[model samples]
Target: MATHPTFITCSSVSFSWPDGTEVLDDFRLAVGPGRTGLIGLNGSGKSTLLKLFAGELTPAEGTIRTVGEVGYLPQNLVLDTALRVDEVLGIAATRAALHAIEAGDVAEEHFAAVGDDWDVEERARATLDQLGLGHIGLDRTIGEVSGGESVLLRLAALLLARPDILLLDEPTNNLDLHARARLYDAVDAWSGVLVVVSHDRQLLERVDQIADLREGEVTWYGGTYSAYEEALAAEQEAAERMVRVAEADVQRQKRELSDAQMKLARRKRYGQKSFENKVVPKIVANNRRAAAQVSAGKHRALHTERLAEARERLDLAEEAVRDDDEIRIELPRTLVHPGREVLRLSGLELQYGARVAGEFELRGPERVALVGRNGAGKSTLLRTIAGELEPVAGTVETHVPLRFLPQRLDVLDDELSVVENVARFAPEATANTVRARLARFLFKGARADRPTGTLSGGERFRATLAALLLAEPAPQLLMLDEPTNNLDMASVRKLTAALEAYEGALIVASHDVPFLESLGITRWLLLDGELRATSPEEVGSAVR
Candidate 1:
């Protein structure tokens, strides 16, 4: 691996939530000047670590040191809608001072405000242009920009500040392909220390190294995400082999212990028989018996010790194997016949001016992928079909029962447990039946009783998905909007596994091409101003 001087360090760090939930404990990290991909399962404290580095959160114990200024872009970027673009860029005052001086105000305070940055406007415009936001005017309000554009704008602001350390948390969560490319370009151009917590494979592929956080510790992998995966796979393979060898050794030890015990019993029996037959004098026989018993005890202790040691080695070997469970669900009731008409859209005019002229129909268990650029009204269309939105002009008809899982995962009630939430969806299901079904969704035992509000990002998603798929009348037509947005790679794989078993019609809106392709999508529809049929190969060009 390439090496660089350490620019940031955390020593003996510890942090916990006010609710007494421990996050990081005695954590130590050294970050150098390179793009590092920080990854872990949901709730692994990747975000919290970034927040600590960015000084957004303080460590309960230990010291953190940074060599230069830090800029952080949180996962949920919430900017005041009313703030002007210049204001958000943190140059509104400087721009105002420059303008005043240009208008012949020439005050001392204005000069002080402007400082040496007489070309601040030019720099801001150039930064915005670099991020593919040149069209967004400095005078415009944040509300005027799209979500993807807003993310880039935040990054642009950080770039303008010329910070030496930058931290981005799930920067590509809601971004479109074009915006993601722009952000990737920005990452490529970064020369300072950069750490990004993201699950986007394409984004992680650009990193110089992988920092895997698990069980309150960070393990460094010497390359990109793919390299890390390869390394981890090799490690697991070795661990499994060791486990097999250890298991064999344990079995061998157990057999030896059993054989030794049998031999000792046989020896005792022979000794007792000899004594009964009076082959030797009573004193000599008794002495022989005492000697035999002592030897048997030693033999038994030796075998027992060996067996215990072998079992201990087996346990250590097993602990090396990872147990990342996958969701395995079967929805037989959701199956649709090949000739069944699942849904139809007639003269569909979505709330955001995107429309489907004429008619659109879905039949049987057809899988549809909704592909579009940001602000292309994909979500709006899905919402319209799901009855959450009143279409400007259209008719949506569903022959089979349907369900929608939105991007926010707000279908769950925060106060309710996972089982309770699922019960609400499937009112007719008995409590025992609900619990049995939840186990298939990977929520067994106490996990099913966890309140929705306290679940992690991945857990919350699974719970919501369970509630939808396991509803009273199993939904035959399911609509999902950006389902993989913030999910980790493992969670994404689990989602794919769950969907593979879903025997129903699916309409998923996503920018993740790999995920879409894995679903065996029969149709690809691009939503711009109008819905149009397209192929997977044509999606990029059509969206661009």
Candidate 2:
């Protein structure tokens, strides 16, 4: 780990949405010059905090200050397709001014616009080249480039700004493998106060430190994301051990309290019996009973206080335990036989004419990874197979029921609740049954009733998955296009757990190598212009 001067600070910062949901309150953070990966569970306000740092969102209370200029790249970057590449790189004015000067029309405004960046054009071209966008000329419109290239173009713009602080929110969301590598190189090369909000483990590995935002507070970890995970695991293990000890102590205190009560009751009974038997003088007996009662009362109070203290300790110990919920659900009905033919693509050609070179067959409960560059038509292929889009040529035949979980997760109705959405898919299921299944997707109790429109990125993804899984007749083939996009690590884990139980054939189009590997993918296909069987190493090499 390294240390640098604090360049960004937030003091007593508080922010809440219009719905009165507080994201950050009395928050305090100071970031120094270095790459710091910002991570948190979904809805924990990672994006909101980045927005606050970028001054895109004003805090409800307190103040934020920065040492110098800031540049921010949002998660959902929407550049006007008609805009030229130079404009996106923010060098249009400079290029124009330089051109005018070269044309011998040296106006004062043109010189001012050019400033000291006389080499701006060269710098811009170099930046674009660094991000693998050199082929995309400055004059080309954004619509002419791929989605991943567009993202890099945005980053190139930020680099051109040369801001003291750079903030990126899920910069690799829609990027392909090669694009991710390009972005990773950019992050590794960054020397400013860089704070990136991302769940990409590979990207997080490039950071000098990790800022774990949890429960509205930032906890600094001394190293990368893996280091943070190791520290967190050790902490949780110790906490669990403490909880066990506390539980034992609480039980001991309870037993002691019960024994004290029993002893006091026996003494009271014996005293009454002695008094009735006339074993002593009435006055003596009265004194003995009074003394005994007072002693008993004190003993009872002491035991009660001890018990309460023990319970409090137990509660505190329990609070230290992490709440890492897993998605647990049975998917027996979704299972497919090993001999069953689940998918067959015969000379399939997508709308954009990225064709499968020959016949393809996916049998049994095979897990397949579809790897390709961003405009390589992975989504188009998946949609065409799902019957959402008609293919340009060839035929796609499915022997079993299938479901496609698109990148947008638009299958869910925004107006409906999570349970309601599931019910739509499972029309035969009762309300209670729908809720019971929804709980396995991590939507339980009142949360299951939350409108789909209000759910966070991860929650919405889970709800969409639940709908697809719980649909009637059970889909034996599930297709997911970049399912891990925008999901936090926790959500990714939950999804992995859910998919673990799925015995259906799965064709997932994703660039997340770790996630794809975790799925135990039986086959890997690279769809550049034609689909071909490939290995992970080949895929990595191709992208690199």
| Candidate number achieving the greatest lDDT relative to the actual structure | 1
Cα deviation of 384 in candidate 2 (Å)? 3.2
The TM-score measured for candidate 1 stands at 0.89
TM-score of each: 0.89, 0.89
**Each candidate: what lDDT?**
0.87, 0.86
C-alpha lDDT (0 to 100) for residue 267 of candidate 2: 88
Pairs that collide in candidate 1 are none
RMSD (Å) of each candidate, 1 decimal: 3.3, 3.3
Q: Number of clashing residue pairs in every model?
A: 0, 0
Q: Write the per-residue lDDT of candidate 2 for residues 469-488, one digit (tens) a residue.
A: 78978889989998988788
Score candidate 2 by lDDT.
Answer: 0.86
Which residues of candidate 2, in runs, are more than 4 Å off?
1-6, 329-332, 337-346, 351-353, 387-400, 410-434, 449-454, 471-473
125 Cα displacement, candidate 1 (Å): 2.2
Report the alpha-carbon TM-score of model 2 versus the true structure: 0.89
Candidate 1 error regions (>4 Å): 1-6, 15-22, 58-64, 337-342, 393-400, 413-438, 444-454
